[model samples]
Structure formats: C-alpha cells, structure tokens
Target chain A: MHEHQEPTPETFSTPVLSTTTATATAVAAEAAVPGAMLATPANESTTAQSLSTASQEPRQGEPTAQSNEIQLTDEQILTQMQAIKDEEANAHPLVDNSVDLTELEKEYENGSQAFKNKIKNLSDTHDRMRRSRGDGNCFYRAIAFAWFERVMLAKTKPELYTHAIKAMEESKDLLLAAEFEPLAFEDFYAVTLETLESVPTSTPEALLTAFQTDEISNSIVMHFRLVASAYLKTHQEDYAPFLEFGQTMDEYCSMHVEAMGRESEEMMLIALTKAMHIGIEVAYLSGNQSADEVNFLPFSPDTEPYMPPLVLLYRPGHYDILYRKSHCLEGVV
Target chain B: MAKPMFARRLSKELKDLAMNPPAGVDIIDANDFKVWKLGLAGAPGTLYEGEKFQLEFNFGPNYPLESPQVLFVGDNVPIHPHIYSNGHICLDVLYNHWSPVQTVASICLSLQSMLSSCTSKERPPDNANYIKTARANPKHTAWAFHDDTV
Candidate 1:
C-alpha cells in the first residue's frame, strides 16, 4: 500500500551523479567495500576546486591490507574499484542456475522481518530461482535470459521462438522509424539476433557462457535498451504523458533507456514488453506488503501475448531470474 | 570482440565524416581506430570565427557504448566558459549524458554549436587551478556541469 516503488540505486557508474538515490548508493557502496571509493566525488556540486583540494586531504585509513599495493592514481583506483565490483557480481555468472530459496533468505538475515515472511511464503510455490548479476542492466538481462530460456524449451512450441525472432527483427524497424541511424545501432542488433538464434541449438552451459562474455551480454543489453527507447520514441502519444514535467520523451529515453549503466524504470518495462510482444510477471518482494504475501505485477503487450510471461524477482533497484515450480527445463539449465 | 566493433563503427564514422562532413569539421588524422584527430572550426559569427581548434578523440574498445576521450588538443584551445586551459571540457553530453546513438560527427557538431553560441571570449573560471591539478585524462576529472547559458 505504500507509494514508493522505485528500485534502490546502486554504485556510481563513473562520476558521481546528483540524484538522491545515487548519492545514497555511493555512500553505502563506499562503506560496504573499502577502497578508492573513499575518494569518489562526494556530491554533484563538487567544483573543480574541491577536486584538487580533496586530493590533498591526506588519504588515510586505506592501507592495502590484502597485498603490497603500490601507488595508484585516482583514475587507476577508480578503475580497480570498478573491477572489484565486476568481480563480485561475476561471482555469479551473467545468469546463474536455480539456487535454493534459502540462499536468498540469507541476504536479508539481519535485515527485515517482513521480507523474511515473504521469502518464507514465496518458497512454497517457487522452490528454485535463478539469478542475474546486480549490474544496473539486470532487469533487461533477466528478461532477455528468461525469455530466451523459455524459447529454448519450446521446441514443441516453435511458435515462441519464431515469434521472438520476429519481434527482434521488427525492432530494428522500430529504431529506424524513430530515426535512429542504422550505422549507430546495427552492430548491437546483429549481435543480439545472433545470440537469440544460438539459444535453441546451444546447451544451457553454452547459453550461460555466451551471456557471461562482455561483448555478447552487453550487446544484448544495448540492443534491448535501444528497442525500448525506440518503442517509446515511435509511440510518443501513448508514453509522452507519463514523463516528468519539462522532460521530453526523447530526453527520458536518452538518459534512462539508451545509457548502458542507467537503471530501467516502469515505463521502460512497459515499452519493452509492448515493443517485443512479450509479457512479463514481476514479483514485487517488498517490506511494505503484508508479511506473508508477494505482489505480482503484470506487463503485457498490446495484443495477446504469444507465450507465458517471463517471471522476474524484483527486490528494490535490482532484478533476478525466477523459476516457477512447474518449469521442466533443468537439463537445459 | 569489442575491437571489431570499434573498427566497424569508427570506419563507418570516418567514411561519413569524409564524405559529408558536417560544416566546419575536418579530419586531420584517422589512420587507426584507436585515436583520431579532427579539426573543429569555430562557426561563423562567433567569438572564435576564423580560428581553428584541434580536437583529439581517443576511442577505447567500448567506443559507442562508452564515450570517447575528447578534448581540445594541439596549441590552440578555444577560450570559453566551459573549456579549460588544459583542454578538458565541462560538457554534460561528453560525460554523464553519453548515448551510443551519438556519433563522432554529431559530437563535432555539438562542439561547433557550443562554440558558436559563445557570448564572451574567456576561459572557465577554474582554468588555472584545474590545469594545475587535473589528470591527463578528462574523464578522471569530476566535472560539475551547472551552467548552460554561457
């Protein structure tokens, strides 16, 4: 019943941004993992003067305990921190196999009673859930992985795979109709189509490997981002009203959808689903809901959805793949 | 894997820049995909008209996905409210607002417009301090883009 539904923002992408959620995320990230993150731009109002002055503040409390770390420039430190965050997320593959729901329960162990109750209730029907990395693109990555997995299992239901390919193929036209240059977007489109075509013949391990690589995984993310942006741009009448005041749909899509590390919002989900003719069921696991109940929100395409909606577990600013009890594709996974 | 993407994208951009180059943009060097140098002409009717500025574009493997490291290069950097003496630009699109859809041509055009709209001939107020303390790479600088009506 609480009104706030936006995802909790995560680590700063590069330079620290001015958004309140981003600032909170940066502070939490610095505290959670100690390193050069200590030197991050503390706020959006940091003038060029403060940057130089901050450097002279005598960086203390950062003696490298793990290794004989030599000196590193602030740029190098930021780069290393980025690598560490990547490694932590890479601890799980771009997509991971069904983990016992207890594993998720462990994350909130000292955290929340309401979340604990929902997880306890969730395990009854959803015995196992797969996960995607917590990188900002997790929502798009999860939806892509989940839909592709379903299409792979639909060997008997050839229509699903065929439909997915059609949707992907038509998305290029959407980008073009929205006036996105072919030269700018063609590479992402080609990589995405190649990955989708490989899913059917590829084993689950092979699929996981493909998604693990940066080129393939990020290209898919980029393509979907473009598709969502294109969908919003071409169908402005339907979505323009939803944008914030003084912000045009083009600006919203540019900032939120096209940028790689930017998080996706509800409008993005609706646009992506409607654009690709896919349905999505997002299980909102929140502390605000009744202790024992999880809310499922549906995002459906304008027409009849061709396949069962791909399900995702949403836990504030992050998305991970979830498996229903009846799903029988363990061998593939 | 990303190298090929950079090659194809950069090559196409080079071809576009060569064939139908935007007004006042000219390529000085682009033999390789990694680094390119292009000349940006300050637009007519601006403070820098008839003045030529050299721009250096360093492309990482992440090229269109990640933005290129672009700055004023060579001897003559433009004197403007957003341009620092060390060549770092305080433009938002170059950093926080980067989108893959933007091209090298588009960037040059944006810079051209940025220069064309200049109302005064001056450097950023922080130019002296910034050039003294900033790193070689502009991306490393935590730029605050607050002013737009320069």
Candidate 2:
C-alpha cells in the first residue's frame, strides 16, 4: 500500500508557480514526443497563463527552490491536470443553435482546397449550425434536440404524440431487462416524459427555448444515452462485431457508449437509431468527399415513406441538428 | 439546493430500497436525501462474520451522473486489506468503474462481497500513514487501486 502524503511545506507554498511550470513542461513534452499532439494544436502558452491564475493559493510552507524552479507533488500534478481538463471541457456551450455557417467557411479559408469544397457543400444544405459543447456528448445532445423539436411539431397531431409516448413507455421493459436499476434511470425517463408532455401546451418557439436550457436538455440527452446503452447491451450480438480492439461488449458500453461525455461512434449511432425506431440521415461534409459532392449516410433508414426522418450534419468530431425545408413544412401540414 | 432531478431520483431509490431491503443491510438514518447512513451486518462465512459496520453515503447534485462519496464510518470500521483505518474504502466500483446504472443497493452488496472475500484480519500496510493525511472526503484523494484479487 503506497501511502499518499500531504503536500510538503516546500511543495505547498508556490503551487501557482509550480503548476504553471509543470503545465508548460507537460505541453512541451507533448510537443517533443511525436504522435502525442498530432491533429490537436498545442495550446501551451495560453494554458500556462490560465493555469497560473486558476491555481488555488498555496497553504503555508517552508522556503523551497526559487519560484521559477518549484517542484510539484504527484497529487498536485494530478489536480492541475484535472483542472486543465475541466477548463477544456467547459469551453463551449451545451448547445449553441445560432452558429453562422459563414464563420465555418471563414475558418477554413486558407485550408486545403478539398476542405473548402466540403464547406461549400455544407453551406448549400445548411443555413446555420447548432454547436453542441465538445464535452463528448455532442451526439446525444444533437439527437435530443432534434427529438424534442419533432415532438413539438407533432403536438397538434394527437396520434403522433401518443405513438411517441407509447414507444417511450415500452422502452422501460428493455432497460429493466438489460439490468439497469430503475432508480438510476427513472428520473431521466420522467424528465423526458415531462418535456414531451409540455409540448402539447407550448408553442414551438417556447419548446425551442426550453431545449436550449441546460438542465432540461442535458437530462433528455442523458435519458436517450441510457436507452441507447440498454439497447446495445440487450442486443450485444448485433454490436459486438463492430467493437474495435478486443474489448467485450459490456466493457465497450461502460467505457464509451454509456459513459456521459464519452464521444459517440458509429456503433452508438446504429444502436440508438435502431432502438428508437427512428431513421437518421447524417450529411457528411468531409475533405475526402468529391470536389462538389457531399456524402449522406442513412442510419436506420425508414421503410415507411410517411415517417419524417431525423437529420444531423456531421463534421469531423462534432454533430449538429439539420433541417430540410420540405421536412419542416411537412410537419405543419 | 440539490438539483430537482437528483432529488427526484434519490426519492425513488429510497422508496425502492425501503420496499426491497437487501440482506445484511439496513438504512439507519436517511432524514436528509443527500446523506444516508447505512448499517451492514458482516456476511456469514467471512472473516468479519458477526461484526457490524456503518457506511456513509454523500451524494452530489450530479447524483447518478457522478458517483456518490461512500466511506465506512463509526467506531467499528472493518480491518481489511482494502479498507483503510480512516474508513476510506479502496473499491473500484466506488471510483473509476462507477456507472450511473449502479444503485445504493448494488454498492452495498458489492462491499458486502468484498468483505466476505477477505481472509486477513489485519489493516492495510500503510493504514497509519494514510489516515494521518487523508482528506475528510475520500473522493478528494486520488486513489490508485491496483489490487483486484480480493
């Protein structure tokens, strides 16, 4: 048993200086080690400065090395690393539905021609983008927002709302069968039901505003994620082959698929789409696409022509809700 | 104030636990939903057979999303390799491996089994040193749980 010690007097006094130096060193180390900072830009200087101010004031301590060469305990280093991770995690909003597409175009102006073309393809289809926070829950958030919008649209149609509610209620058996304790997921399910219940009385604008509210939106997303996890677990045989590496189905879901803020992959999408009996069209705008073409991948494509599909726009690591003009009007009719 | 969702879920869990109390586990005090005190009877066939232990559970606003802070409390803390003198339990299910799907009942059973599997009656090797510096809340400590055999 390795006993963890309190920060010694020498290490306690200059936590700010020590943590700053440590962060800078860690960033420098990442840059030094090839394949460590690949694809991710090294935000060293900004991180160092932010970390210096963000560090808590040190407790009393004995005189130690000069501030420039302070030493940090393993615990202090871990805390600092967690703080940096938290800072990065909260860098974006839970859902920003008013992002301008031109901003994306401006970002890739000087980038590769292929990327530029992909941007043009995206611009042709989407007038704006809704940015989900990069906290690794983007897929769930995007789907939740889209689902709420659909519910709100179907409010005038009693049969549609009833069908959705029936689907939601039936999902409880699946979750229970998958060994999920009702105590752990009931509140999420309740909140989701409550949100759907409110749709009939609320205007679409009001519904949109409520969806933007963090607490309500996140709960709905969490509920969806849980349902998706249950679906994956119950139908493990269908998804096990898709698991990369040698990880077992339970391991994959617990670590990635079910865990909050763990980014979604193709397997999660497939499970969710199939479980909800909802068709999803993901418009992929990637640099790899043909010069003037975009790729639209259908997930759980609808066999019934009358069912309105849930569409999402996918760019490299993020997902956003997408609206097709005709589909939006169809709900009104 | 606790988040509405957390409070609601905890209430449901409290009701469920009341209806279906696990063997060898009793809810001692649950006046406050955020904090619960549970009494556990050592499972038969365990080294700690015939002993009773108290466990404290403190839930954050995140509740199911984040794991609750659980620690052994009271005078009769179990002396086992994974249980520290200060009452902090070194269980992976209480930490990194925690999932929202786990409930208080499941956790109690896991701890019960953990105690049942122990063969030694001695405290952890570094128990004295760790207790001296351990934080009031075990969640604050960065626990490195390497032993899983027990």
Candidate 3:
C-alpha cells in the first residue's frame, strides 16, 4: 500500500486528500472500529482525483522543486487513478473478522430512540457482525463471504460442499445460455470455481485472505453478478415488471445488476439467491419506531435442497454479515 | 510470464475482425495492441457516401475494462454533428458508459451505425471553439453528450 502512495507531505494542508479520506475514516470509525478505517491506504486516491484542482492551489507561491516529474499524459493519469482505486479497495479487507454486535449499537448512540430500541431488540438473537467494505459492492461481497464461510464450516456434511461446486460449475452454462461470450466470462468463473473447489481443505483465514485479494474477491463478486444477471435475463417475465416505465430488462441489468459498485436492489437479491440456490435472510435495520423488532426478509429457493439461509444485516445503503448464536462450528478464530 | 488480459482480449478481437469484419470497417494497421488504425467507409446511402474515414484506437493496459481512446484520424475526418473537427467523438460508450462486454468489433459497429444514422454533414456545435482547447487525447475532454441524434 505504501509503495503505491505518492510522496506528498502529510503535515501540509491537502484539501483533496483530506476530503476523500474523511468519509472512509473518522465517520466510519464510530460504526466499525477506528483502527480498521485508519488502516486504509488513501493518499494516492486523493491526488488522482484532484490532479487538475491540485495545480490551481498557489500554496507558498511558485511550484515545488520537483515540478518536472509531475508532467503526465491523460492516459498516464487515468492509469494511475485506476491503480489507486485498486490499492484503496485492497486497503480495506473485503470481509473483516467478526466483531461484537455492540459496534452497531455504538454507531447510533447519539441518534434517534427508534434506532436505539431496534438495536436493543437485535441483540437478543444475533451475536456478531462481519463488516464488508462499503464500496457499493457491499451487498454482493457480504453475501458471498457469508455463504463461503458457511461452506467452509460444513465439514460434517460433505454433500453441501459437493452441491456448491456443482452449482458453480453449472453457472458457466447459465452465462453461455444468456449469450455471454466464453472468452469474456470464463476467467471470472474460473477464479470463483477454483476457490470454491479448494474450500474443504481451506481454512476460514484462507477464505478471508482470498477475498482480500483485489482480483480474486472482485472476480467472485463479478461472476456472481453475472450469474444473477443471466438468471434475470432468462426469466425476464418474472422480473421485468419491476423496471422503470420504458426501461427494458437488459438495460436495468446492465446498468444496475451486472456493473460492479452498483448498489443492489431487492430484485438482484432474489435473482442471485434463486439462481445459485443459496437462500439468504437479510435483516433490515431502519429508524422506524413503529417496528419494535428488526425486519427480516428471507429469500428461499423453490427447491428441497437449499441450504439454511446465511444472514446479512442491512442498514440504509450498506450490508454486513450477521451471525446468529445458533450457527455452530468447530474452529473459528 | 502470463500474457496480460488486454493481450488475450485483443488477440481474440483481431481474430474476430479478420474472420468476420463489420460492414465498411477494415483494419489498416494492427501490428501491435497499443494502437490500431482501421478504415471506416461511409455507408452506401448515408450523407457521407464515397468518403473514407480512418479510426485510430489507443488501448491502454486496461483495455476492455476501461474504454479505448477512439477518434477519427488522418486528413479526412468525418463531418458529423457528434464528431468534432479534431476527431474526438462525443459518444457515451466511449466514455462514462463503457462496459467490459463491449469489444473492438462492437465499438466499430457502433461508429458505423453512428455514421449511418447521420442526417446532416456538419461539425459539432462547438467544433472550432472545442478543438482550440481540446487536448490531443479525446478521453481527457469532459464531453457533455447533450444530444444523441445526429
């Protein structure tokens, strides 16, 4: 992460740098531990954003002695910016280790009474929460991690693992049937399939590490997104009604479902869960005082063999993995 | 060392273009993946009939993921409402709306269609003013695609 960071003076007032890092750091510290947010390598991202703006700042007059080195082409700037985005994404672990559920409570300490009451009620059943990064891909990341972890812990029942591998293998056919080029999508499918295949021998830490890798984690999220997109495309009659007045199903899926960093809607949740036969229950947390207990939306596949649903906690725009006390596993760190 | 993703996608594109090229589009020079110049002949019935335009595509390391730098090159730049005299095209897919699924062939087809559908033969509204300040690379321009119909 340091290798990617530019050699900008930290003590100086760099507005572009400060503004971008603030949302990811200080404010996020209250919800998820301060240490985790502070650890994100964010310097390069700021410079990449404010390249044109940075040149306008007449701080201490004239240019610094290293002016010659700053000349870069638009292509160079865009590439560097892309690299910084990748590095920033890498800084935040995709799926963090489980933290006590009290972290959620701390976020709303100074807030509304409705939020307080809901948190108190949530404490009854859920023990811990694993945060996924809030990079708009949170919904996909959280669900993928939760399901992969569930597969890792199912040592006693090997068939669940077998079924998972089979489902992943067949997802390729889904992509092909949906007219996705094999050359374009095969690589993404391979990264996810190979990782899932190694799950029985893999540890929880190994799964987390794999998810942390920029290429591996994003590939899994992307492949799953394609799976969901393909499912939605093939079953247009079922989901097309949810689209806006004149928008077609393909337009909606291309803009929202298939694109990375596009926030997920309920339709995406249903399509992804139903396509993979992986049931999931999402607990919706809102500040509506009318509801005493947290609202849970369970997506169940219409089949006999779907595994017990993995849990996810949803606040306004983000998602994080939720663990119930009932989930029993032999070894977890 | 493994071949980079751009290399693989480009080779496949090169093969596809050779086997079945899009109508009125032919590659002039594709010696390497970094830059490829292709000829785009005006459609038979379009306003630009009998005119031949060259399209230059600059592929960065992030080819399919990031859009290629596409523009009309050579002396005969197209005179279309969306195309600037400087060869920078104001199209959504080439910029903000880029997706990985769109291949080189797809972009050529899009350019062909953009030319085919043209109802007028003229420069964009702010052509002279824009070309004076526009950077050599079209991607740097913060294009406001106010109109799609040309």
* Candidate that would win on TM-score: 1
TM-score on alpha carbons, each prediction: 0.82, 0.76, 0.78
- List CA RMSD, all candidates: 9.2, 7.8, 8.9
Model 1, range B1-150, lDDT digits (tens) per residue? 545777888988999899999999999999999889999888888889899999999997777887888999889999988888888887767866788998998889889888888888898776666677566766655455666677
Candidate achieving higher lDDT, 1 or 2: 1
Docking quality level of the chain pair in candidate 1: acceptable
DockQ of each: 0.39, 0.33, 0.17
Per-residue CA lDDT of candidate 2, range B1-150, in tens? Answer: 155767777887888778898879999999876899999999887788899999999987677776888999999999988899889988866765676777899999999988888877878888887887665766545556666666
Ranking by DockQ: 1, 2, 3
Q: For candidate 2, state the interface root-mean-square deviation in angstroms to 1 decimal.
A: 7.3
Tens-place lDDT digits, model 3, residues B42-90: 9898887889999999998656655788999999999888888889887
Model 2: per-residue Cα lDDT over A281-318, one tens digit each: 87765444345666677777223422476778765555
TM-score of 1: 0.82
Alpha carbon lDDT of each predicted model: 0.72, 0.67, 0.70
* Cα-lDDT of candidate 3: 0.70
Residues A1-333 of candidate 1 have per-residue lDDT tens digits of: 011111111112223222233323422332211112112222211221111111111111212132223435645654665665455554556667768888878766665587688888888767677877655677888988887778877777777788889998899899999999898999889988998898778887777777787778888889999999999998889888777788888788877789776667777888889999988887866555444777777888998888877888865555788777655544322
Categorize the docking of model 3: incorrect
lDDT score for residue A139 of model 2: 80
Off by over 4 Å in 2: A1-93, A109-111, A154-159, A244-248, A285-292, A301-306, A329-333, B1-3, B122-134, B144-147
CAPRI verdict (incorrect, acceptable, medium, high) for model 2 = acceptable
Q: Give per-residue lDDT, candidate 2, residue B99.
A: 69
